[model samples]
Target chain A: MPLPKDETLIFFSKPDNALVKAICGRLIPGSPEDPGAVEAGAHQYIDHALAGYYHSQRTAYRRGLTAINAYSQSQYQKEFVELSNDQQDSVLTDMQKGTATGFESPKAPDFFNTLFQHVREGTFCDPAYHGNQNLVGWKMIGFDGAQVAHFDSHMQVGADQSERTPILTLADMEELNFPAPENGY
Target chain B: MSLPKVDVVIVGCGAAGGVMAKELSTNGMKVVALDRGDFLRTRDVAQLDELRWQTRGELQEPMIKDTQVRWRPDEKTDTIGLPFLMASGIGGSTRHYTTQHWRMLPHHFKQYSENVARYGASAIPVGTGLVDWPMTYEDLAPFYDKVDEEIGISGKAGNINGTIQAGGNPFEGPRSKEYPMPPLLQSTVSRLAKPVLESLGYNPFPGPSSIATENYKGRPACTYCSFCTSYYCFIGSKGSTNVTVLPVGISSGNLEIRPNVRVIKINKDSGGGETTGVSYIDATGKEQEQPASLVILSSYTYENIRLLLYSDINKNGMVGKYFMDHHYPFVWGYFDDTVTNPSTGPWAANVAIDNFNGDNFDHTGLGFIEGGVLEALGGDLQAIAGAGVGSWAVPMPDDTPSFGEGYKQALKKYFRRIASFISQVPSLPYDANYCDLDPVVKDQIGMPVLRITYNAYENEIKACAFMQNKAENILKEMGVAKMKKAGLFTPPTTTHEVGGVRMGTDPTKSVLNKYLQSWELPNLFVVGGAVFPTYFGYNPTHTIEALAYWSADYIKTQCKPGGSLTQYF
Candidate 1:
C-alpha cells in the first residue's frame, strides 16, 4: 500500500510533458551527443513522481505548466513548447528575472522557481523514478552508485583491516560504468 | 478506561529522548516514552538505496498535502507550495542526519558578555537576538564527556587537560576523556588539503563524527557508504539511536516505547497547575491519554516549541519564541590536476578549521560578536541529479546547460576533474526571527501549525562573507583553479533549526530555566536544542545530548523530591 515504486508522476498530460521537456532543455540543456533530461527519462520520471512520493506535487506542476502556456500565448502568441528555442529562452529569462506577469500566476518569482526546481529535480533525481536512465547521471559524474561497502581493491588501506568487514559506499556502484555514446538509447 | 501512570512521559526517541529514557528509566523511575513515528533498526536503515531515498528527500518528512508554511515580511501563507521543511517521526531529524558531532567551544556559552567586554556592546548587530546561555562550558563539560563515552564519539582529542595535540581542536576546553573510536579515513581531497593548510599556518583536523571508526558497543563500524546525510545506514554502522541507545533501553524492562503515537498536547491540570499527562493520537487514529508525574519535551527544537504552544502548556506562552538555525553557505572551486572522486566516500569531509569559531577571533572591527568554523566536505556523484562534473560546475548532460556542440566537450573534460568546498557558519538568535502560530494555516489535527519568522542579521551576513573569504583562501592554498566565491548567500535556510523555548534564569525572559525546568510548572522540563539560549558555532546534537543527561541527573537527585526550586546540584 506504500506504493510499489519510489516516484509516480502526477499532473502531466501529453502537452504538459512537452512543456517540461522544453523547460528542462533550457535549465539543464542536453546536447545531441550527450543524453539530456528528455532522453534520460525525465518526462517519465516526472509522471511517476506526481503519482508517487508527492501526489500533490502534481497540482503545483499543473498550475505551473498551465501558467507557462497561458503566458506564452500572451507573450509570443504561441504554445510554450512550440516557440523557437531562443523565444522559449526569452520567456524563461523574463520569468526568472521576475519581469513576466499575468496568467493567474502566484508571482513570477515563485512560479519560475517552482517550475525550475521541479524540472531540475525530475531530471537529476535518482533514476528509480525512470529519470537518469541507464545511470546517465551516475556515469556522467563518475558516481559509483550505491554499493554495500568500500570493500573493493580501492578500499585496501593500512593493514590490520578485516576481510569480512564491509566497505559499502553509496558512491561506488560496480555497474556505474561510464556510458559509451553509441550504446546510449 | 484507566491508563497506566508513570513518573515521566518523554516524547520522541532521538538523542535527547533516548538519553532521558536511559537515564530516568535506569534510575528506577517508571517512564512511558512515546514517539509519533515508527521504530527503525540500524540494520533496517543500512539497506538504503539512492534511487529510493537520497535524491528524492524521501528519508525526510513526508510532504503533508497543503500543510507547507512560509515566512515572508508580511507573514504570508498565501503561497501554495512553499518548501516548509522539517523532518518528523521517531528520531525526528536525527534519524536521517549526518552525525557530524562537535562540542561547542568554551566561548560560545558567553558570547554576549565576552563580546561586550572585548568590544563595545554597540558592535553587536542591531537586529540579532544573540545572548549568553545561562549555563557555562564548565557546567556542561563533565556531561559532554559522559555523553561522548556512552554514545561513542570518534576523533583524536586535540586538547586533554591542558595538553595540546598535533592535530584536533586546540581551542577546545579541557576534556576528561578520549573519543571511543579513531577518526575516519581521510580522502584524497583531505590528503591534498593537509600540506596546503600547514603551508598557510592553519591546522586542519579530522572532524569529530559520530560515525564509528571501530566496532564499539553493539554497533558495527562505518562502511563509508557515502549515503550518509540523506540516507539511513543500511549496515547499522552509524551511531544513530536505532543502533546505540534505543535497543539498550528497550532491553532494560524499565523503559516502555510507543512509536506512532502523535502527541497532541501536554494535558495540564488546570486546578493543580501541574502537568497531569499528555493526549496523543495513535497510528490507528485513536486518541489516548498517558499520565505521568514529570514531562520532558525531547522532540526536535521546532516540535518541542510547537507542541507546547499548541497545548498552551506554558503559562506565559513563551513557546516557539526564539527559533534559530545554523546559516550554512558554500564556496566551491574547480581543480584540474587531480583524480578527485568527489562522490566515493561518506557525506562528511576530513578537514575542519576551528580558528574563526566562537570568540576565537578578535572582534575589534568585526560586525558580528560570534564567528564560525570553515571546512570542506568531500561529495560523490551517485546519481545525475548531483552531477556537476567539470571545471565550470557543469551539470550532467541534462542536469545543467548543454547550449551548443562546444558545451558537450565541456562536460566530458570537466566532470571528474572538479571538486568543491563548503563553509559552515554560526547563526545567533534574533528578536525579529522567531516562531509562532500562523493566523491562517492549520495542520491535519486542526491545530495551527507553527509560523516561522526569520531574516538574516547584518552580523550573520558579515560572518558569512568572512567565512567565505577564509574558505576561498583554503581552496587557493590547496591549489584549486577557479575557486569561485558564491555570492549573496540569500534566504537563510531552516537546516540547523535551533532555539525556540530558550533556557534562561529568569522565567519572564525564558520559557525553561537553566535546569531545563519550565518556569510556570517546575515539574515540567523541555530538553533538546530548543532550550539553547544562544546558538553555538557547531551542530547542536552533541550539546543537546550532553544537556539531556545533565538535566536527567538533576531530575533523579533533586527535582524528584518535590522540595525547593532554587537548589543547584
Candidate 2:
C-alpha cells in the first residue's frame, strides 16, 4: 500500500491522474463563482483514499478508468481529458446508462456509480479528510459542518450567522474551544 | 473442562440478555452471562465521523463466516449473504441504535383474532403464518410501563388508563403513566407537520425515545446531536444497556458478565430433552464448560435461532422457521424557503403519525392487511449524505443527472430544503421464508452458517406500496415544490429483525412456550424478537426487555425451590 504525501500521486499514475481530475471536474463542475468537487480537491481525496481505506478498489479503478479513456478514443478520436465539455458529458451519459461498449468486470454503469459516489464524498466529507478544501464545498452549498450540539437556539436561525455560528468542523473543535465530549473524542 | 455449578447461565449479553443479567442477579440468583464481544462504552468508541461510523461501519459487527447468513430473494434464486448489521458488544446494537422506544398496539398482540373478527377469515392471506400472541397487550402493559420508568423514555402520554391524553400517541394502548421525562425539543420538520396533519385529521406527536430530555437516572440529557444512529453517545444520555442496567447488575455482585467468550453449544442431558449447561470458547481461545440449573438464550434474533439449530435443539423442526423483517419505503421533497437544517438534532426526532400503522386503519378493500409508521424524516438527513447521489436509498429525481452543474445544484437544493418521509412496514412470515444451516458455507471455526430464504409476501408488498402512497400524500399536503418517490422494496437498514423461534400455544407449531421457555426442555428459556408470534411495525427493543422482565419474574417465583418449571405444560 502506497501512502500519499503532499501533492504526491500514490495510487494513480500520471495518465490516470489526468483522467481522474477530468472525470471529477465533470462530476460536479463549477465556476470560480461557485466552486465544486474539482475546486474541493476531490481527486486528491480519491488518491488519498485509494492509498488507504479504499485499497481494494485499486484494480477496479485501473480497469474502469482505462476502459473509459479507451472508449473515449474509440468515439471522439481523443483522450477523455481532451474532449469538449458537451462531448465529455455525452460520453459520460452513455457510461451511466450502461450503453457504452468495451467494458467488462465492472459494467459501465457500475463504474460510473462508484466514481460518482467517491466524487461526492470528496466534495462533502470533512476538511480533515483532504476534501472540502478551504471549506469551499460547505460554503458553496450553505451546509453546517460537523456540529455536535444543536440546541433550540441552533435550530432557530436568522440570516447567515457565519460570524456567531459559522460552519464548524472536527478540526476546528480544538482551537475554537468547543466543549470536548466527556468520553474524550 | 467443566466449571462449578451456577443457578443460571445466559448467552450473548445484548438487549435481551443485558436485561436478564440485571433482573435475575438483583433477585439474588447467581448468574454467569457470556458474550462473544466486548463490553464497549461511549468512552471506548466515541466519534462524530460519518465515514468511520455510518459508512465504514466502525461499531457494527464484522462479517465472520461462522455468523454470516446466506440470503436469497426466494428458493428459486442462488444465495448471496452479508452479515446482517448488528452490534456484538454487551449493549448490542442498542449502544448505537437511534433509541426509538415504542410499545406494541393492542391489535398487534392479537392480530390473527383481530383480523378475523374485523374482516372475516377470508381476509387472511394464504400461506401466511400469522397468529395471536399467547400473551396479550394487557400482559405486557405493566412491563412496558416498567421500561418507560426504569429505562428512561421521554414522551407525552396519549392515553392513561381509559382516558385519552393529549400530545401522546392516541393509538397507543392504555398506559399507567406519562413518560419518565418530557419529550425532546421539536425540529423544524416536527413544527411544520403539526397543523397540516391536524387539519387533515391526523394526530402528530413527537416520537417516543429512550434519550433523556432531563437528567434522569444519573445520565445527562441528550445534546440534540444528529449523530445518534450509528455513533455512540458521547455523554451517556441515551439509555443503552451498558449505561443503564448492566452497571446496576454489576453493583449487586451477583452477576458475572464474561466478554469475548463465545458460547458455541448449549450442552444437553442424556435424554436430549433438557439443557445442562453451555460450552464456550473463552477470550484466550480455550474451550470450557460451566454447569447451571437453568439456561437462557438471549442473543440477537439471528444468533438465538442459529444457536438452537447448531445445538440440535430443534426437536420438532420449529427452530428457525417463520423468519421476518421490516421493508422500509421512503418519499421526500424539496422546499423553496424553509431551512430545516436536518443535519441537527436526534436521528428519530420530530413528528410522526401512527394513523396508518398496524391495524389502526380499516383494511377494508385497501388491498393490504396492515401498514407502517409514517414520519417526517427531516431530522435524520445528514448534509454529507444529501450530497451523495443515492444516500439513504433516495436517489435524485427521475431524469435528473447525478453529475455536473445540475448535480451540484441538486445537492444544494436537497441539503437545507428537503423534508423526507418513510414508513417502517413489516413483512409477515410465510412457510417458504425460513432459515436453516447452510450446506456450503462454513465459519472459520468449521461451523456451518445460517442460510435465510426470504421473500416479501403479497400482503407485505401491498403494505409497502400503501405506506409509500400515504407518505407521498403527507408530503404533498406539506406543499413541496419538487417531490421524489423512491422505489418500493428498498431493503431495511434499520434492522428490526424479529421472528424465527416463535412462541405459540401449540407445542408442534412453536419453539418456546408463552413464558419464552423451550417446550422439550423446561429449564431452557429463549427470549428476544426470535420468539415474536408476529411482526408489528415498531422497534422491538422495549418489547424484548419487557419479555425478559416477565420471564425472569416467573423463574424467580414459580421455577424456584417449591415450584415446578413445567407447571404451564
Worst 10 residues of 1 chain A by lDDT: A176-185
| Candidate 2 residue lDDT tens string, A94-153 | 999999998896899999988988888788778788888887777766767767677786
lDDT of 1 by residue, B1-569 (tens): 43788778898778889888888888776788888666765434444365455555554444233245555532443423245344555555566677778888888888888888888778776766667888888999999988778777888888888788877888888887677788887655676677777788777888887877777775667767566765666655566665576666666778888877888888777674678778888779888888888888887666777788777766676677767777666676666555555555675646777888888778677666677776666643444335431111234322334332244344444554455555566566777778777777787778776677766667778888888887778877777766655553434344567788888877788898888988877778888888887887777789988999889888887744565532321
> Positional deviation of B129 in candidate 2, in angstroms?
2.2
**How many clashing pairs per prediction, in order?**
38, 1
DockQ of 2: 0.39
Q: How much is A4 displaced in model 2, in angstroms?
A: 12
lDDT of 2 by residue, B1-569 (tens): 69998888999777788888889899887889888777776655545666666655565654342377678877888988664678777877778788888898998988888999999998888888889999999999988888887778998889899788888888999998888899888777767777888988999988989888988877778877677776677677787887888888887899998987888899998988778999998889899998888899998777788789999999889988888888877787777766767776886677889999988998999877877778787555554666753224345555466678887777666567767787888887778878888889888788788788888867888888888777777778887777877666644234687789999899999998899989978899998988997888887888988998888888878755668753421
Where does the lowest 10-residue lDDT sum fall in candidate 1 chain B?
A: B389-398
